[model samples]
Target: MNREDFWEIVERSRAEVGDTRDAASAAAVARHVVARLTALGPSTAVEFQHFYEALNEESYRWDLWAAAYLMRSGCSDDGFDYFRGWLVAQGRVVWEQAVADPDSLAAVGVDPDDDMVDCEAMVAAAGDAHATSTGDREAFWAALEQTEGDDEPAAPADPAGEDFDFDDDEQMRARLPRLAAVYRPVQ
Candidate 1:
């Protein structure tokens, strides 16, 4: 499927499922994508894998990770996957903005009262399906590693003397107030 078609499926699943974080919603979308692939033939599965990988890569920004930490306390490697999936579910505008500059999410308007939109369910589901499609675990990862590459290398520290604490919630919020403002779940 083309990018538009792929996004439509994601959005439609979001509309029906509401929160991708919900296990049921993510599973539904995963099933839907796998089912749709049958019509296009086997190659589409690979294509879907590539698309999902690219999206995952696009979200590998420190800003987005800060947002994820705010939303979920701390974002692990897998948590980042879910975060990117959630970003994708926000639709093209939000996804594009985040991809361009993750910090821009702070400025983008969002209804704070709305329930957490967890797009990761859909994304993880797609990736899971792709890996399972061929039943070759080793080859699957080997292929993904080749295409996805290693996670972005850590940035060199500044020579000046300022230190950044990624693990500090307060620091993250101060650094990305707009993003923290919108995504911090109301207690």
Candidate 2:
């Protein structure tokens, strides 16, 4: 599946189910995606993983980090994952704009000052997609039920986490002046 195809799956799933925050809703989407992708085999899995990775990388920006920080009152390590999924589900325009310049998100209504942009449905849908692609049936459902604020096990680990320096709030603020203006760093 290509990026557009992956997005179609997500959109269709969301359209059908409306919300994916609960395990039942997420699992329903997971079943739909898994059933649809089953015919294509592992290539579909690889494509989903690749698309998800690129989306993850795209979100590794100061502006988006600041938006996530303000939205969550300080984003946790796992919160970044949900944020990336949320970014992807914002659809092509927002995704492309954010990738090109994270500041563009402000124009797209992702202002750091507004903390009500809930991305739980998007996050759950992406988790379901990952579950379908990887054949990890239980993990996604279990993740949906989890209440400990831990990172959901949507996909397997990628060792490239060492590449970003998200911990440096000062540097992020320097990079995103607009976000800095609207959001005070949460100590």
Superposed on all Cα atoms, the candidates' RMSDs to the truth, in angstroms, are: 5.9, 8.9
Candidate 2: tens digits of C-alpha lDDT, residues 1-187: 5788887766665566655433345445555555555544545544555566666765665556655665555776676666665665555666777666665555654445445444544444445554656678666445434432355445434423233454466765666555554565456
Ten contiguous residues minimizing lDDT sum, candidate 2: 155-164
Please, what is the whole-model Cα lDDT of each candidate in the order they appear?
A: 0.60, 0.56
Backbone-clash count (model 1):
2
Runs of candidate 1 with Cα error greater than 4 angstroms are 18-27, 101-121, 127-163, 182-187
TM-score per prediction, in order, is 0.62, 0.53
Q: Which prediction has the highest TM-score against the true structure?
A: 1
